[model samples]
Target: MPSHAPDRFDEVPGDLSRVGAHRAPRPRHHRVRAFAWAAL
Candidate 1:
């Protein structure tokens, strides 16, 4: 897969790309959260 978009976001040019929950993940939440988010 490839992203045509550059590292720079036109709308948020001042902010870096956010690739997370944007916060520390909840403790031991992945077992449930992963399946829910991933539809697994």
Candidate 2:
């Protein structure tokens, strides 16, 4: 057998949604709390 170079991940598009199933949107409780604290 001979050595072979693996395919590069950079060939994929920067936008993952275009190539794979995208995650569902969800509430960001942490960001809300951070903003609330910053406001104080």
Candidate 3:
């Protein structure tokens, strides 16, 4: 019989709320110009 121990288990949460939570949105002009310049 195979037995597993609960005490040896660990729980991890996917928490993105704490990361980059205060970053400002990218400017629309920069995004559009970047692609246009790259395509040339």
Candidate 4:
């Protein structure tokens, strides 16, 4: 059971770092594009 604990703990931070690094730029671009289209 102790071996399982470290594996489970590693998953949460791993997912967060990936999302922060890779996903952070995309939604921001989409948001700006939507605003631009709405203004037009």
Best by TM-score: 4
Sort by lDDT, best first: what order? 2, 3, 4, 1
Which ranges of candidate 3 are over 4 A from the true structure? 1-28
Backbone clashes in model 1, listed as residue pairs: none
lDDT of 2 by residue, 1-40 (tens): 9977768643666554544443333457968998999999
Model 1, 1-40: lDDT tens per residue? Answer: 8768666434453354544435333458667888898895
The global Cα lDDT (0 to 1) of model 1 is: 0.56
Give candidate 4's root-mean-square deviation (CA, Å).
6.7
| Model 4 weakest 10-residue run by lDDT | 16-25
Of 1 and 3, the candidate ahead on lDDT is 3
Candidate 4's displacement at residue 30, Å, is 0.2
RMSD of each: 8.8, 7.9, 9.4, 6.7
**TM values, all candidates:** 0.26, 0.31, 0.30, 0.31
Full ranking by TM-score = 4, 2, 3, 1
- The candidate maximizing lDDT is 2
Candidate 3 lDDT tens digits, 1-40: 9987766224334552433444344567987899899999
Among all windows of ten consecutive residues in candidate 3, which has the lowest summed lDDT? 8-17
Supply every candidate's count of residue pairs whose N, Cα or C atoms clash at under 3 angstroms: 0, 0, 0, 0
Task: List ranges where model 2 is wrong by over 4 Å.
Answer: 1-28
